[model samples]
Structures are given as structure tokens and as C-alpha cells.
Target: MNGAQSLIKTLANCGVDMCFANPGTSEMHFVAALDSVPEMRAVLCLFEGVVTGAADGYGRVAGKPAATLLHLGPGLANGLANLHNARRANTPIVNIVGDHATYHLQYDALLTSDIVGFARPVSAWICESKSAQTVAGDAARAVQAARSAPGGVATLILPADTAWNEAERPAQMLRDIGPAPVSSQAVDDIARLLGNGKKTTFLLRGSALHGAGLEAAGRVQAKTGARLLCDTFAPHSEVGAGRVPVERIPYFAEQIVDFLKGIEQIVLVGAKPPVSFFAYPGKPSWCAPQDCQFSHLAHPHEDAAGALAALADALNAPAQSSIRVPLQLGGLPKGPLNAMSAGQIIAELTPDDAIFAEEAATSGMPLLVTLSTARPHTHLPLTGGSIGQGLPLAVGAALAAPERKVICPHGDGGAAYTMQALWSMAREELDITVVIYANRSYAILNIELQRVGATGAGAKALSMLDLHNPEMNWVKIAEGLGVEASRATTCEEFASQYAAAMQQKGPRLIEVMI
Candidate 1:
């Protein structure tokens, strides 16, 4: 067997079944070996960013790692933005980056560059397979690293010669490593703080913001009267009816400070101290008040659910119970569709168990408030603050949970970054409904321009933030990419098209003109 075949076998044996790839000539052997290994599913993407971003989505839903195949240094560089997002999300991903043949590196080939240098900033672990005999072992180790506590990004550089060379056998499958145990001392300390009369808030993220961890936090709040708030951008959160309701920290620093006005102590569970996404002219970077005390109950790598449950047990909290949100479908506006109307439409139409991937910069915030009382669903936000992850993430979520419907609401400017994901969704016949908020401008940048104290008196500075010089035709773009799409000018038109799209199968797009 060749090294590529052995590596594929090793990955499959280690429970990695999916690979998102955008390969070039250097990765031909690995590409050719895909036919030999029927267990590893190969998904082709047009851009490296989509390849990486899709893996991030799959990892968040699948609770494991998905491998990504990139061509070379330049190819790896193209995918770095999404990899940055993956790292911030703490999603497990194995990046298989192809490199030049071992012998060809001495000649200083045109495509040769520092692959490791580009990978270190985003990767938690990186290794290069020097020979055919070591490639399979390296692949196993890469999966092990990716599946470690809190999960991480692991990069494996494969030379062409090593991939094509003969290998004697595949490596042994590596067993999964569970998250680290929560510290009992930390749990006891948090319980003491709660027992005191001080007003405290629980800041949550990662696993603590969803599933059983959320229930534990709810119990603490029910018994102690403490508040619960999640990070501004969570990798994956359980939301909607019947789940514990947790508000997200506001994106703006001033709003966040106001939100935590009365809180005297903060107990962090798998969450970091709140910080502004960017510094403003006069505002402080830290969101909490200057006098607020901070306490760490559990780190990201620790078992957050267990830690919270222990704290609840110490406080004699009540048993878990259903928490319901009354569905309130606001009156739909009759005129042109704005953010409020768009949010209301989504709140009324979203199905139970749906997956919502959001990147609708400033316009999508209203949906967050509206959908809080909607049907039970999973909400995956842009964890790394990257612009182009929304569509690609929806593609991966649909692939991971085929039985559930997936919805993507994206800004017109951000959608342009990874619109290639729509083509993949069409090719795979994925069940995803994409809603484009076509405001014909980078609305977030306009907000930032004023926040950053930019004196924009000239037309040129304003033009840089506007997209109206030639407005994007999303319907045609979706049709060209093999997905059926329509344009909606008013709330009624948007509601009609959205209802029809949700009822149908496969990929569809609705461009909301606002």
C-alpha cells in the first residue's frame, strides 16, 4: 500500500470520516487514493476558505474533527482566515497541507515556501511526515491532537514523494481523549461566592453555554438568583423554546457595561473575561465595571458541565425542568422590508430543531431578540469574528445534520467572500435556505467608521463603505451557482418566498432587498 492509502485508512480507523478538500497537482496522490478508501467521504470545494470553514461547522455539530486538504503554502494561506475562526471556536480540525517532493526542495522550486511558518499562528499542533513509513503514524497523531481536550487545529504537512512512496501497513487507531476534569476546589470556591449575598453573574461559553451545562447554570440561577450571560459570539449555542434562556453580552462595550451594571462578581465557566471586539476612542476595552471581581470556575479545557453541576449540588439547587418561551410573532410590516420586519418573519417561520448560521453584521441583531422566543433550534454564530464563515458554516451544518433544516442569514458584503459555498451546497443537494440581506453596502463598516472617530466629510471615504455603485444581483448569482433563488422587496414578498423555500428540499436563496 502507498503512504496516502495508509494515511486514509488510519484516519478512518480513528473515527474521522469526512474530508473537505480543494487540492492541486501536489496532492494528486492523496486525491487518487480517495477511490481506494470508500469509508472516508471526500467533499470538493472551490476555495480553500470554504474548505476550512466547512470543517469548522462540521466539527461544531459532529463533536469531532474533519480533515481539510489544501495544495501548498499559498493554498494553506488562503484558508488561514477560516482556520483562525476554527481556532477561536475551539473546534477540532485536521489540516492536511500538501507540499513539494522531498528531493525537489533542494532546487528552490517556485511553489516552495515556509508552510510551518504560516501554520503556527493558527495551529495548536503541527508536524511534517518525513518518509512513507512515518506518514501513517503522523496522521494518527494529528487526529489525536485534534481530538484532545477542548479540541484544536492540527496541521500535517505531507510531501508528494512521501505520499506516493510505498508503506508496509497502516498505523493503529488512536482512542479519543476526554476533556480534563473540573477542579473541586474551584467549584467549592464558586459555591461560597454564590452563598454570599453579593450580586454575581455567570459568564458562559464553549460547552457550558449549551446542553447539560446550560441546565446546571439555570439551576444555579433558579436557586441563587444569579444572572447568566453567554459570550457575544458563541461557536454553537442551544436556543429557542424549551431551553435555558441566556442573553449574549452586547457587542458594543458601553452596552455591555450597562448590562452588567449591578453585578459585583463574575464567575467564568469556559469563558474569558469580556473584552471589546475593537478599541474605541474614549471607551475602555474591558466590558466589566472597574470594581467588579472576577473568578474562574472552569477553564475551556475542563469539564464545564460537571463543574457547574457540582456547584449547583453544593447549593441544593432544584431538579432540571423545562423552560419554555411563549411564541410571539409580531405584526409584519407592509412596506419595504427592514431589519425588524425581517427578524419577525424568521421568528414566525423557523422550524423546530432548525440550525441557524448568522453573519448578517449589524442588520441581524434584531433576529436574535425575535428568535429568542421561537421554536427550539441550534444557533451557530461567527465565533472568530470572520466575515465569510456564515454560508460555508451552513453548508457544513446541513451536511452534519441532514435530517434538520439549516438556515443562513448573511450580509451582502460578507456573502461575497465565500459565496462559492452555495455551489457546493447545490452540488451536494443540501437542505439549506440562504437569506441574503442585500443592503448594498458594508453596513458594519459604516457603523465602525463613526465609532472609530473617522472624520468622513468626503464622498470618497463614504464610497469605500458603500456597495451601491453596482448593486449585487444575488438571485442571478444563486441561479448561476445551480440553486433556485428569488428577490423580495416587501415584507409580504419575503414571507411568501421564505415559506415556500422552507417547505421545499435542497438549496434555495432569498435576497431581501432593504
Candidate 2:
């Protein structure tokens, strides 16, 4: 068998069956080998960005790694932005990048570039296969690295010669390394800190933001009265009714400082310390209070759920979660269809077990408060402070959990970056409802411009932030891409269209004209 055939078999054996691909000549052999392995499902994406972003979504929702196939250096480079997002989210991904034949590298071909340098920043582990005999083993190791601690991108560079050459049997799955346990002594130390009279807050991420970990945190909070908070843009969080409330830290530094002012100690569990996304003039980068102490009971790669559970046990916590968000609904808006009204309509209509992939920019902020009390669902936000991830992210989430409906609330500006995802959604006939918030501008950048102290902005400076000389018609775009769509200008119109979309199942788009 050829190396590509063996590699595909090994990947499937390693429990990675989904592959999002945008390949070229160097990867033709691998593409051809897909038919040989019936287990590995290869999904075609029009753009490399969508390939990587879809992998990120699948990984987050699937609780495992998903493979991505790219052409070469330029192709890997094309997908790097979403890879950056995947890296920051700590999502597991087996990124397979094809390169020129080993013997032809000396000729300085047109596509020959430093693939290693291009992939290094985003990959937790990277390697290039030297020959067909070793390619299967390389694939096994790549899967192991991707599934390792907190999870991350593992890039395996398969040379063209390595894929086309003859190879032997597929390698067996490697033993997955699980998160380290939080020592009993460490748990005692944190338990004591929590028992103290000082005001404390739990900064949670990763596994701590959902499931058993979240339950344990709630019990501890009920016993100790500690506050719970998560990062501003959480990778994946369980929100809405029946889940413990995890308030997100505010986006701006000043807002974060105000949000966390009274906290005396911060206990981290698979989370980073509070810090600003970017440096601003005269704003503190570190938003935590001066006297606040910090302790890490569990690192991002450690057993956060176990740590929280142990801490709860040590504190003699209650048997059940202290308080949960009760199922509730608010009145719908009637006149104008703005961000607030849109959020209300979405929250009111969202069914239980739905998934929301949001990159709604300025338009999504108003929805957060209301969504907290909506039907239970998973919320996946942009973790890398990058735009253009929401649409493709929904594509992967829907594919990963086909039984659940996926709703994407995306800004017009961000949606343009990877709108090709819509075609893939239609092609796959995924159950995704995309709501494009077309405000005719990069609304977030306009706010940032003033925050950064860029004063005296003229028409030219302001023009750079605007999206309106020609407004994009999302309905036409969606229709052209094979997905049925509609446009909504008033609150009554949006409420009707969105409610109808939520009740049905195929790929659909609703342009929320602001």
C-alpha cells in the first residue's frame, strides 16, 4: 500500500475520522487514498480558512481532534488565521500539510517555502515525514500530540514523495495522555484559602466551564459564596437555563477592572490570569486589583474537573449545585429591529440543546444578558480575538452534533472573511441558522479607534471603518451559495422569520438589517 493509504488508516484508527480539506497537486495522492479508507470522512471546503476553522469547531464540540488537509506553505499560510484561533482555543486538530517531493526540494520550485516557519506559531507539535515507511507512525504521533493536555494543533508535514511511495501496515493508536490530577495537598491549600473570610472569585476555562467541573464549582460557590467568572471570549461554554452562571469578564481593561474590583483572591482552573487583549494608552494591561492574590489549583492542561471536585469535597460542599439559571422568557420588541431586539428574539426562540457560534461584534453584546436565561445551549465564541470564525465555526459544530441546531450570529464585516463556509453548509445540508447582523460597518473598530485615542479622525479615517459604499446583500449571497435566505428590517419581521427558521432544519440565513 502507498503511504497516503496507510496514513489515512492510521488516522482513523487513532479515533480521528473527520477531515476538512482544501488540497492541491502535492496532496493528490492523499486525496485519492480517501476512497480506500471508508472510515475517514473527508469534507471539502472551498477556502483553507474555513477548513481550519471548521476543524476548530468540530474539535471543541466533539471533545477530540479533527484532521485538516492543506496544499503547501501558501495553503497552510492561507489557513493560519483560523489556526491561530484554534491554538488560542486549545482545540485539538491534526493539521496535515503536504509539501513538495523530497528529491525536488533542491530545485527551488515556485511553491517551495518554509512550511515549518509558517506552522510553528500555531502548532503545539510539528514534524515532517521523511519516507513512506515512517509516515503511518508519524500520523499516530501527530494524533497523540493533538489529544494531549488541554489539546492543541499538531502539524504533520507529509512530503509528496512520502505519500506516493510504498508503505506497510497502519500503526496502532497511541495511548492518550490524560490531564494530570490535582494533588491532595494542593486541594487542601486551596480549600483553606476559600474557607478564609477574604472575598474570592473562581476564574474558570476549558473543562471547568461546563459539565461536572461546572457542577463542582457551583457546589463550592454555594458553600463558600465565591464568585464565578470566565474569560471574555470563552472557547466553549454551557450557558442558558439549568446551568450555573459564568459571568464573562468585560472586554475593555477599565470595564474588567470595575468588574473584578472587590475580589481579594482569584483561584484559577484551566484558565489564564485576567489581562487586556491589547495595550491601550493610559490603561492598565493587568486588570486584577493590586492586593488580589492568585493561586492555580489546576493548569489549563491539568485535571480541572477533578481539582474542582476535590476542592468541593475538602470544603464539605453541598450535594447539588447551589443555584441554576431558571427557565424564563422576556417580552419581545415590537417596533425596531436592533441588536437588543434581535437578541431578545433569538433568546426567546432558541430551543434546548442548541449551539450558538457567535461573532456578532457590537451587535451581540446586548444579547448576552437575555441569553443567560434562554433554553440550555452551548456557546462557542471567538477565542483568539480574531474575526471571520463564526460562520465556519457553526459549520463544524453542526456537523459534529447533527442532532443539535446551530445558530450563528455574525457581523457583516466578520462574515465576509470566510463566507465561503455558507456554500459548504449548503453542500453538506447542515442544520445551521445564520443571522448576519449587517450594520454596514466595522462597528467594533469604530469604538476601538476612539478608545485608542486616535482623535481628529477625518472622512478618510472614518471611511476605513465603514462597510457601506455598497451594502452587501446577504440574501443574494446565501441564495447564490445554495442556502435559502431572507432579509429582516423590522422587529416584527425578524421575530417571525427567526422563529420560523428555528422550527425548521436545513441551512438557512436571515440578514438582520440594522
Clashes (N, CA, C under 3 Å) per candidate: 0, 0
Task: Give the alpha carbon lDDT tens digit for every residue of 69-113 in model 1.
Answer: 999999999999999999999999999999999999899899999
Candidate 1 clashes between residue pairs 3 or more apart in a chain or in different chains: none
Summarize candidate 2's per-residue lDDT along 402-484 as a digit string, tens digits. 99999999999999999999999999999999999999999999999999999999999999999988879999999999999
Q: Could you tell me every candidate's TM-score relative to the true structure?
A: 0.98, 0.99
Q: How well does model 2 score by local distance difference test?
A: 0.94
Candidate with maximal lDDT: 2
lDDT of 2 at 309: 94
**Considering every candidate listed, which one attains the maximal TM-score?**
2
lDDT of 1 at 259: 89
Instruction: Provide the lDDT at 473 for model 2.
Output: 93
**Candidate 1: which stretches are off by over 4 Å?**
321-324
Candidate 2's TM-score: 0.99
